[model samples]
Target: MKPNAAATAAALHYTIVPKDLAGHIFEVTLQIAAPAADGQVVSLPAWIPGSYLVRDFARHIVQIRASSGGKKLALKKLDKHSWQAAPCRAELTLTYQVYAWDLSVRAAHLDASHAFFNGSSVFLRAHGQEDQAHVLEILRPANVAGKSWRVATSLPELKAKRYGFGSYVAADYDELIDHPVECGDFLLATFEAHGVPHDFVINGKVPNLDIDRIVADLKPICEAQIALFEPRTKTAPMQRYVFMTMVVGDGYGGLEHRASTALICNRNDLPLTHQSEMSDGYRSFLGLCSHEYFHTWNVKRIKPAVFVDYDLRLENYTSLLWVFEGFTSYYDDLMLVRSGVIDEAAYFKLLAKTINTVTRGSGRFKQTVAESSFDAWTKYYRQDENSPNAIVSYYTKGSLVALALDLLLRTESAGKKSLDDVMRALWQKYGRDFYTRSTARQGLGEHEIAALIQGATGVDVARFLAKYVYGTADVPLAQLYAGFGMALDGAQASKASLGVKASRDAGDCKLAYVYEGRAAHLAGLSAQDVLIAINGLRVTAADVADGLHSAVGRYRIGETVELHAFRRDELLVVRAKLQADDMPALSFTVLEQAALLRPSWKKTTRR
Candidate 1:
């Protein structure tokens, strides 16, 4: 079929104005050049892509009304998120008020200091005209009473200057919603990666930030990724990119888009002025950057079949998160080493941390990563205290799966092939130009993963998936490491175990997690148990460290100690025995001769 030239010519126009600062409201006006012959059905999405929770974004809509030719048209409620214009053939204009208060990447947030919003939260899809061009006019906040504001987004500016408040355009509705907007007096910087421009904008109160260090660390990682997928051309998929971040006191997460990613990091995670050393917090932030940047090719382009045409009204299920998300997890840190941000020793330590985290979780034996991905809507995203005992993280376990597969390929082919080959193949076959054709766009199936790996490296991994991904068998990390001349310390860090992890809450030492069949579990101790004393001595939240050691340090292994605790107003003395610590195995070190075979930043190749 040929393109609908007339429909595509008439664009859907939207104007977003920050109306109220204190009340946290944004006024949105959507105008269409033509309405449907019968009636136009307009609705807000239940949830956005990248974040898989049905958030019911339409609930934030406080009021709505429709009109044509300056005359009011009856608006009937079709459903929770849907609204219909009553038999209107004239051009439709819908004006709605949205209450924006959530402060996460998933939804919209507006305050006196700044404003940010995803299109899903403010722009209602013009039901029949989603394929047509969409125009957005971002109006300056009518309520702001502070410093001058600028805009930051990946959306193409039509009539506005770069980072200016004016008209912007998208090819279609999908592209329109994918570009999230931020308006504030933000700290901004620019850098070049493989000749494509990139922006780093942070909206927070961090003083004397080391922007040069972040740029220095991020440039090579971005260039490495650009070269990874397109080795011959070294071309990034996007014409330009942006990394919009919000720095808070204690926050960490990211959501990937086609041309940009929205991220939140703790202020301390950023390198301070004159700080040359890479702190753990800064390393973790860099890892987050790598993780989301890797998603540019994985989930955003090489998507699962189910996500190709997302149904925002309900849940979209897929069992191959271990491939998309898991593979990205594996490469997130690997890119750090490949880009020379960290040394081999540091990389090994990071790998060991992931290994110990996966193996220590009892949920690995109970739920496979495939099952976890499929049930992410109710299980993974909405987790409670029992989450650790019942479910495994697809991100952590998926990285293990990728590591095992990479090692297996390298070992089988004498380091001639690896997971890189598989990813590049997937990108060339499925992701490249995926969004160019809306009709019959291809996506990876559950079975195609195995076929691709076999074709790339001439190694079969059907049995591996059966036992580890779909089945709940643990991947033998130590055994696999031993083959590569690496030694894993399987010993626990200590011989003391309470079987319960504790944290401070309101100056009280409360149990955070109580494992099943452990010392705390067998002793009638539960989560949120506040410790009052041990062996008749008082203990507070701060004293748990020295207090716990002094309480059990005097006893030998298998000796019992009287534990006095408060379980929600019920005081009881329980006898708990000293047991071995369940701390994760650590200290993975490379042996002498095998160190020669380890890949380094300079050794990364297309093989």
Candidate 2:
């Protein structure tokens, strides 16, 4: 059926109200104009997109009931997330209450101060009517505490005023859940990028928040990404975009949506009115913004084949996340440099940090990037204390893979083609007309990426993919950097190390992770062991704060020392041989004369 015809058909209407602010409950009412002949089946999603974990969102539904024509209808539980209502001829309505206390971006959170939620966490999907339009009515809270709250979402307004609580319309169920809603008296700002308006909304108390500075910094980054995907037209896919952020004392994360992104960051990450210089926290915050913004073209649209129709009921596995997520990671920081937000030195520092992160884990040698992508649901998202020793991150290593591919493409094609060309090709073939041409919405195949790269850049990368992506071989980043007129070297630490990461736990030095095959592991020290002393010297939590390795730096390498620690209230002593610090510390420098051959490597063309 045509898109408009499907939309004009009887739509599924929903009304959501922030009821019981102190109790953190949201009452949702779903009305189906044309209920199924036998029965209507509805279900909540098992997980939100982007974050690859089965959250079982339906578990949060507190109470549910069904009714038709003022008569109560029998409802039967179908499964953990699905339910079926008895056959009804008249319009069917189901009301349920959701317990929304999750404070992260993926789920719902509500309190006396503010209310935020993703549709997947609140709205129930009418199984058969997913193609029809979905209308949402957000009612303002009745209590006096929420008198000044406003709504911020990318959902198209139907009868409601912009930023006012009322009704909104979505193309279908897929589009409905793609926009997260934030209701509060938020700090709002607007800017245009390539003639497209972008909204920035902040939902926490931030004294002296510099909204102007943020707008200025974000404009160029958005324009650069738009140009990257559509260089000739410089057009953006969405009519309007939003960056909905929630600020707190100390937090950092972001979840990408179709036209908007939900982010949480520390209050200190935001620039103050009097601050002039860029701080590390601010740079990191900008990088996070850039990363999610790039997703506007990458995974949000150019998805893996398995994601073409997301089975939110179960896990969706794919091995191509290295391209979808990893490539985006590589460009997130590069866009900063290309937009002139940061210079070469700053960009190199960020790049070096990523390289060191990937190199620090021995798990990289055991797991391929493709394996990491496939096991994301199991290992990456559900990480534990020994995660670093057991698994590799598709994000960090995938970015390195992207870097290697870009450098190889540049060298092989004489700089005529690079990863940029491949990305543009992907956008053109798989992403550009995705939303507009609904009939042709298809995702990239897992094994087809190698062919796509060859066709786009005229460079065969099958062997490269075999060695770096499918195999557990490092990307040889040092050689790749040298080819781009840059030198990559590791910096040695000045402190001796126990090769164990520690944190202060109630004034005790708690070992968080003992590196595999390192000094601590060889000495039989385990995670969760609280250190009491080292070589008869009392070790305090303050020593762990200084650096676990620094506390042991006083001893010489290979020197034997007595270590006293508490394992579950049991005191134990063991002799340990100190080793040199082996944490990866990478540095990059430009080879000026060689770099002159490739100016694009250092700087990108700005619009």
Candidate 3:
């Protein structure tokens, strides 16, 4: 396609009108100049970035019509996803209406109440013209007042009553399509810290939020992020950053970007009332805020080489999601501790919860962190009933791996080296210095990570990664903890065990493994028979432990108990002798409490 200076100007003049009402219908009219060539096609994307599935965005488009110079032009459906313009050289106006009832974050929706648009769902992706700049002039319904219309976008808002894009260029179409825009009567707030401006574009009503307190609480999070980049780059990339959010209506998630993030959260998630002080939700929300903000360095800039330039049409597989997302997940809470927003005890509680949840899942035995990261597109993103049985979460496993690695590095170097050093090294080498040059666009390679560890800690991490990360073997936590002069004190837990190594199977959860002399074995419970009820409570293996807790030693040793179960779909009853299973359990303790085992600014807890 040749550069058409005039066409570029015409593209900027495009406008959209919203006739939102009680009915689930909204129309879009695209004003385009028809080229001389026939069979030129306009198409919608099958999927958007951040979301790793092919959701045909064009399916929602109904009743498409094309006209030229006030005269109806013949249009044909060239394919299921595209429409062709007739042979003519005239001003072409294309119009279409979409079914907007599903009020999801990924698609478009409009009703008498409100409207939501995820860019790719409503805006036509003008092919061949991506090189040129375009502007969107929104014409709100006449009955709608300015107060009834608010706009949200990651793109800087132009003062000319329109949103403009100067050469819609990115590493790939994935980045381009992921940018979104929202319109409605929503609240907006602005705050600044560390000389960087921030915007909070809230869609819908405002909660009883205390603006000053919220900002004050966020200062540390923002400062920690600023500090992370300052030593490496000395400056923030953009003068202004935005957070386009949908406040509180049954959905919550965020998609990160270079200068902004699009988030969907519940209004209750935002602390506005005194009741918020009593709930843990506020802390979780702050953790979320810190997590995404930290991404400004970890992921948005220092990304995996595979993700540096995305392939929007398919999965971009990499064995580093644990490094990217898992590390981020670990830091989300750690940032709270480092930022003074959360205490050390609270941080450990979060870690303990993470361990309990991740370790309890049987998938850890089936998938390694490296494999989990690589298979995110197929297994992680598209979760199913068999997910727990066959897959470990990279986010969960990777964070644990990061924790182990951090402890290993710190102890090996006598507290002289830490994960922070590794992050700073990467930031300095790749994010700050290398990302600016054209030649540097090749992106960070695997060797870069290996080299950083050797230079920073003088430790050979290759074998550790190859074994624990790349293979489906249980992580050597005992060895890693020993390095930190600590030992897992679960010797008591394993002593008391039920006959069952409770686990889910074939989507139909049940206790699959039973050991002889265990309490469950003495209780007359056997393997391969469908576990119908435990202590008269009908539940899966996940619920049996909780049921046991409420028993209060009701089923003691030598007590005859009624065990109801199903054998191959046939319900049966049996009696068995109940006895306690003696097994040692796992817990955390310091082998030799070190005085230096504390955060940079925190008081020492060593005795």
Candidate 4:
């Protein structure tokens, strides 16, 4: 477990500067203390961890060259993302310019206002010396516009002060890229959760930003998650944490990191100083934060076995995303209620919405959650028009699976056990001290979950896993809810539907998706078909608001109508018999008398 003396001494040195803010370019220099005797290969990662897609980050390099002892060394492109430098005994220096225009969390982005980048998008890996200590020096931009810019990253400081640009250090290459850097004159707030300091940094402007309310609401959520993993100690895994968010006009996404998270949210989602009521947007933003915060323990550490050692050059596939993402989805909302941020009524509404989303898509009938998790790289990420008909989402359906498993665990164990126990067990065995321990890190295996569940909760879930996870059977939510002092109800739509999702596109009713075997699909309607009219009545873009609600809702079930639509340039007329909406409108109601006896259904006070 002792550190290698040579590797420790010969740290990989890197320097990055915002060379041209107007042109959105970053100049990066890598200094290898000792070059290999044979040709030393250097390459940028093809993808970032947490995000499953292979993004081929090297394509962003505008130009790259190598040098040793002030003389140019030969650099040859070996592959799409790798380059080989001629053997040199002197310290090898590789300089490159990265085009950082991507405005997402996964890649680098730069402009006059701000600069942000993931290390994966800017730093190239020195192949043979990846395990060596890595030091990063962030140089201030020469332009006057960046004079006030401040650096924000979770990377441990070497010569740099917190939030000030100078130098940072990482134990190895993996640790180097795990922390993303954000440089801007951003708004900042600080809060303490169970003795750990957490920073909330906002990059964009808001009219009357309410920093106190956000910190108050998020503090409990963070503390609850910490307690969930380490209930007895109530200790967080990180020394310090950061919530680095970029506020935009309209955006909502987050990618988790070990001690920090990169997030993007709508500016309107932030609370105003005068605003006292919780808006849906604000609740959603809080939920987003909770979701990513939970990942500090879940996927970020208790990872799938394959993710333990990531091969950034290609997709690292795993069939347990359901457990990682789906369970996180289930807990994201639940934590809101547990932290006293939202009430039971609001929690139930969110739960119902998730159920509706899963049931509305017919893809669940064809594909299981396991298959959905396995094919996430190809099917989930690269979805198209037929996605609703072909693939299921491990996120939505996996949450349902987690819900069902939790309910079943509580029921079978006579309320003595729950999914919380299993999660804590996973943390104890796989997550807790994952980074601090000197032994080889082990991730959760593909087929080890069922056994772990039984061992932790004393409940056999083989049949449950087989039916819902491996097989395409829907979770028996109604039956599960009945036992938990709740009633699940669905309202059947009375009006006839084309079973097509439509949107207003260019002053016309554009059919976005026609569900398979539905009235529209049976009438030969396809996606992207422009609906012209129905029964001699003109259909405009207004009629398609909320998915053809006005145009199609007027007709009753079993009614026949003449539909005219354009499949590209060809006009088609077809008489179709409308069918009742198959989409489930689900809701849950708490049975008062029965709920009194159920501890699982009862709400608890915030710690």
Instruction: Tell me the alpha-carbon RMSD of every candidate.
Output: 2.8, 2.1, 6.1, 2.2
User: Which residue pairs come into collision in candidate 2?
Assistant: none
Q: What is the lDDT of residue 498 in candidate 2?
A: 88
In Å, residue 590's CA in model 3 sits off its true spot by 7.2
Residue 263 C-alpha lDDT in model 1: 93
> What lDDT is reached at residue 321 by model 3?
80
lDDT of 3 by residue, 54-137 (tens): 677788887888888899888888666677888778777778876676555567767554566665676665555543445555
For residues 428-534, what per-residue lDDT tens digits would candidate 1 score against the true structure? 88898887755688899867888888998899999998899999998877777777777878664455667776777777888778877677788888888888777
Mind giving the per-residue lDDT tens digits that candidate 2 earns over 197-262? 999999989999998999999999999999888888999999899999999998999999989999
Q: How do all the candidates rank in terms of TM-score, highest first?
A: 2, 4, 1, 3
lDDT (Cα atoms) of all candidates against the true structure = 0.85, 0.89, 0.63, 0.90
For model 2, the stretches where C-alpha displacement exceeds 4 angstroms are 1-9, 593-607
Best by TM-score: 2
Structural similarity to truth (TM-score) of each candidate: 0.95, 0.97, 0.78, 0.96
Residues 1-607, candidate 4, lDDT per residue (tens digit)? 2234465467999999999999999999999988888989999999998887888999999999999999999999999999999999999999999999987889999988889999999999999889889989999898787889898888888889989999888888999999999999888889999999999988988989998899999999999899888888999999999999998998999999998999999999999999999999999999999999999999988999999999999988999999999999999998998778998788889999999989888899999999999898899988888999998999999999999998898889877888999999999999997888889999999999999999999999999999999999999999987887789998968878889888788788888888999998998889999989999899976777666777778888999999998988999999889999877789988874333122254544434
Candidate 4 error regions (>4 Å): 1-9, 593-607
Clash totals for all models, in order? 0, 0, 20, 0
